[model samples]
Target chain A: MISSSRFLPRVSGLALFLFLVVPAPSLVPARAADPAEIRIGYLHLAESKQQPISLLDEPTDDDGIAGARMAVEDNNGTGRFTNQHFSIEDMRLKPSDDAAAAAKSLIDKGILLIVVDLPPGMVLTAADAGRASGATLFDAGSSDDSLREEDCRANVIHTAPTRSMLADALAQYLAWKRWQRWLLVTGSHPQDALYADALKRAAKRFGSTIVEERIFKDTGGARRTDTGIVQTQRQMPVFTQNAPAYDVLVAADESNVFAGYLPYRTWDARPVAGSAGLVPTSWDPAHDSWGAVQMQNRFIKLAHRRMKAIDMQAWTAVRMIGEGATRTQSADPAKIVAYIKSPSFEIAAFKGQKLTLRDWNLQLRQPILLSDGRTVVSVSPQEGYLHQTSELDTLGYDRPETKCKLN
Target chain B: MQAQLIRRGRIRRWPPLWLSLALTVGATSSAFAYTAYVTNERDNTVSVVDLDKMQTVKTIQVGQRPRGIVISPDGKFLYICAGDDDIVQIVDTKSQQVVGDLPSGPDPELLALNKTGDLLYLSNENDALVTIIDVKERKALAQIPVGVEPEGMGVSPDGKIVVNTSETTNMAHFIDTDKRDVVANVLVDARPRYAEWKSDGSEVWVSAEVGGTVSVIDPVKHVVTKKITFSVPGLRSEAIQPVGIRFTKDGKLAFVALGPANRVAVVNAQTHEVEKYLLVGQRVWQLAFTPDQKYLISTNGVSNDISVIDVADLKVIKSIQVGSFPWGVAISPE
Candidate 1:
């Protein structure tokens, strides 16, 4: 079956043109038609030049796109039985490149499914550019809550978890552990402030009390100095002294300023939680239960690195597209998108449960893993917190709390 | 065994399980003892539990990551799918030692045996192929490609058809035993883990762990006839993931293992309705029934124990602690 399709490309120009222009569907049997080709576009912005705290924390060059590539292989494995084929066209945009123009070019090539790894602004730009073409966008990068709340788009589905979801997951675990009092530390960056805002909201929702709040200003200095921990060892304890008594120290450090240096440097001897210690994330390398070992092994063989959160989000987005195609059994994007948004649509991504899309805001519902860098400490939406619809709904903005009115 | 009794004109054919139970009561002065072999996926060991003793008798070291297990027809040997080793290990029941190995394909997560126990079907999860092996010869007959991530295998009652459920493809492929090709494909819900056929061969029930439902498929028409859904109060629907399924020999009752919900659903096989939910250990994976139909046992993955249920009363009678991450179970015939 594959040889016949491969043989068609080797024909002469006139023979191929005639084969293409002959309108052969009427003459040939339905089963003998070529496999339906489903092309997916992966649009990602170039990585920023910020250095990770540890040298071991550096990312691979194909961080998110490698996962999408592996999913394409998995899709083709399943597509053999369904008579369909899948391919991905990846586009990496530079700092000055227009994301909208990049998205339009993908749409011009007849790609209907686009997975975007971009910031919140660039995601919105690409989503708007594809809206008129009836192209669906999957947000695999941005975690800003506004993308799923006030700025939600009908054509864009978010596979990434929002900051509020991560914050709530951590707060729920803390509440379950009876650590009700938190000393919140905020970095001076804007993203850190937004994370701090989310943590405050979570603390209120989960009945935890923030005893005190402090700000750690980012001074103008190189992040990686020659005398790194020797200086940090003395500076951190003095900066954290004289805080109110708290069960835990929650650090909202999205800017990579100081969270990693706070675990053993706190003055009050409290465990750190938000960005460094016991961090909440969608996926982690230490997660091996619930058939995840198969996925981890396959990914390691593909990428030659441990799978990260972004890799998992990208993998899930592409797998969702593959699942939509298999269920509809057609290459039609309209049917596939409609099926994905329906009540019955669910995809299993080795998360020990099925992940479904929220009908109101187009966010994927999933469990958040709390990791301490070595192993998964726990998964959140902790024991007693319940929701009428799904236990996962308890971790993020519920239906009643969502401000999204999709267009 | 029951077929021999009916052939001797000792009992009626219908409701054979109950008649066999009654005969066991009249024939034995004490309760009949049956042995259960459970595969612990994490610890890579098999815990042997004596049903009458209601405790683990012995723990035997096996190959890496043992998950699926089955017993021979004459109750002489046990076949275990050592997934990481990628071979099916054969152990003698009486001697409790590894006797031999079958050439299963890569990553055999589940297996099924024909009534005569000569042919073995393995779902090689990583390879996406169903490998059929001749047990006595210990050679692979054929490796037939099915779907991606095949995890469940069920052979039809008459041994004419084999059903394999692929998790990622979310479909059940029915393969003809003689031709060894997929004759029909029936789409079901997501992440189907296990398949069970009715003794009368009227319907096949497939449990989808992620979709949280059991789709009842008609083997003849190759279509879903009905779906069984489970609900426990105060628990989310996603938490009620159905993995392993088993039905009574009389086909009146069905036991579905609900993973992470920490409960086992008792469903009416005839009506396809969930009758009751019995609370068990955390993350229940697979189930089995003793040969006499006296007890039902479940392997709880997270809690690392087995919950024993009285079949007649539908109550959890005993909880036996086993090795870590106990996943699959098989009981020996007395």
Candidate 2:
């Protein structure tokens, strides 16, 4: 642990002196080539909102960080052959903690790659701080479209699927099922409104119509109490009673306040989709195709829990660092970032395909898994949904739809 | 079929991977009692299938997780990797029974034989080692350290350089037999599980099960020259994972087992163009051709059967039921 700033110069001199005194052998190339110590930093929110799901679906303390750690283990497994060693530093910030201060602390320790698992506001602050320090930032949690759109940071890459991507995935599946009419219900949260905007954009792009838009107001009440289920059972059906006829009820509840209660309690007896019944995500626990069982089993053994999309996103962000280092055979962040932004960069994340980054917004191009909580129903970028370049382009904002001018 | 093979470039070499392939082709010319050995991974048994009759004559119980299978150069014995038991079991082809065992390290998954047949190379998947055993002494020789989860082994025809493909590392490590050390590491796609040398020995093809592509490497240069892609209609592109690869005797054609797409891609070896996709059983893992070149058998892991394809017409002639999760396949010239 070279902690003292004054001793760093002496250690450098000693390293130079040792290099001159000793002749390095050629037999062991692994030692000769491996001089780089690639370190990554993970910044996440210390206090997150309690997600209301079944007891089996509760989040863990190391939700995003655990996935980043698992990816470091995976990277080290392959780093042995690539002649590189990887390490990750995890920093958690309180709700009142300044994200830029945490970013500065990580940068002070010589971390050039940082994985940010925070809300949209915090993601911006960290990205700004990381950019000034010549560090590359990966957004592993924020799904807000503006981060990849008008407010896109030049140094930030997104492994998390945008709201537009998720909405597009759901819209494509709905259109494929000939469910053109949708009864849209959105929560009153700001994030929920942003998700609704993307859902509207998807409906327009994919030839679907929102029959009516209804806002589910956040009447002040605690939902985790024992008497909440009975209240939800009576209130939801009556709330949805007077809606127009529609094929499916699409919910945009990013706040998780009401979507989980809409499935079996709908008044129209229609299948509920979008963020609830059949959700479009980067990964699901039931995803067991294309040799994903191996990855899932590996995760279960390590984390002793089911892998969520956040975990996969964080894992991918760190694995990208390892992949870039291995490909370029250098620990330089500039070189790694350049190689990652190139057209030839790709990494397999048990998604049944090699995922590439859209050179336009640096968003990862991946197929979305539409899982129904228990089993994977199907994957999006569905059959007939085609694009001029890649079918995966149809599931997200394409190159032509970008206003992001990264300076 | 019009094979649209695009040749990237011709690799030059003298007497390449063909020495063993040439012998395999020559052995097929005679009416030898050619037998095909299939390793049933989940069943922990070895199925001795008669190629002429296209049937399993006997099922010999081996250790747990019997995967990689290879016939001895003399054509009398068969060597297999029983992964969970951490040992390599030898089977007498004539008697169709487990005859002996080799001192392999932990979790042996795949094996290969040198041209001289004096040594056997087996991959210890869990330990990331390539264990070499001297056949004459029946003793362990050396354990060469490699990348993580090394699963495939392919020895050069000249018995000089041995190739070990690591699953997690996604690299083809070339080890020099003389020094018993890794000479070079060539990065392939994700989860490279198997490697096969071209008949002329100019190139080595490695299959990446998760990357859904095959990397063709120049053995001398130790770099991937071309990446082979596949397109099967109605099959999701991600499902076209190439696992086990085998080239025909004349080096004109190749067969790649697509793990879950339930198909095998037949390609023109020279041009690297996919000629056809032959629909087979579910989760086809590995493939082997009879010495007579009359039939090609594929082990379907999920369906627990072997699909027999007539090599002449490239059609599935029959699907024979086997034990659960049939994995590696090796044909005998006895």
Top candidate when judged by lDDT against the true structure: 1
Q: Write the per-residue lDDT of candidate 2 for residues A202-268, one digit (tens) a residue.
A: 9999999999999999765665788778878898899899888899999999877888999999988
Write down the DockQ of candidate 1.
0.26
Q: Tell me the lDDT of model 1 at B227.
A: 89
Cα lDDT for residue A198, candidate 2:
93
Candidate no. 2 TM-score: 0.78
In model 2 chain A, the worst 10-residue window by lDDT is: A1-10
> Candidate 1 on B163-237: residue-level lDDT in tens?
999987788988888877787788889889999999999999999999999999999999999988888987878
Q: What would the per-residue lDDT of candidate 1 be over residues A4-76, giving only the tens digit for each residue?
A: 2322433445554654565422211246778899999999977767777777777568989988988897888
TM-score of chain B of each: 0.91, 0.89
Inter-residue clash pairs, candidate 1? none
The runs of at least 3 residues in candidate 1 whose Cα sits more than 4 Å from the true structure, single-residue gaps closed, are: A1-30, B1-31
Give stretches of model 2 more than 4 Å off.
Answer: A1-34, A49-51, A178-180, A207-209, A242-247, B1-145, B158-161, B175-183, B198-203, B209-241, B250-285, B294-329, B332-334
Candidate 2: residue pairs that collide? B16-B201, B17-B201, B28-B291
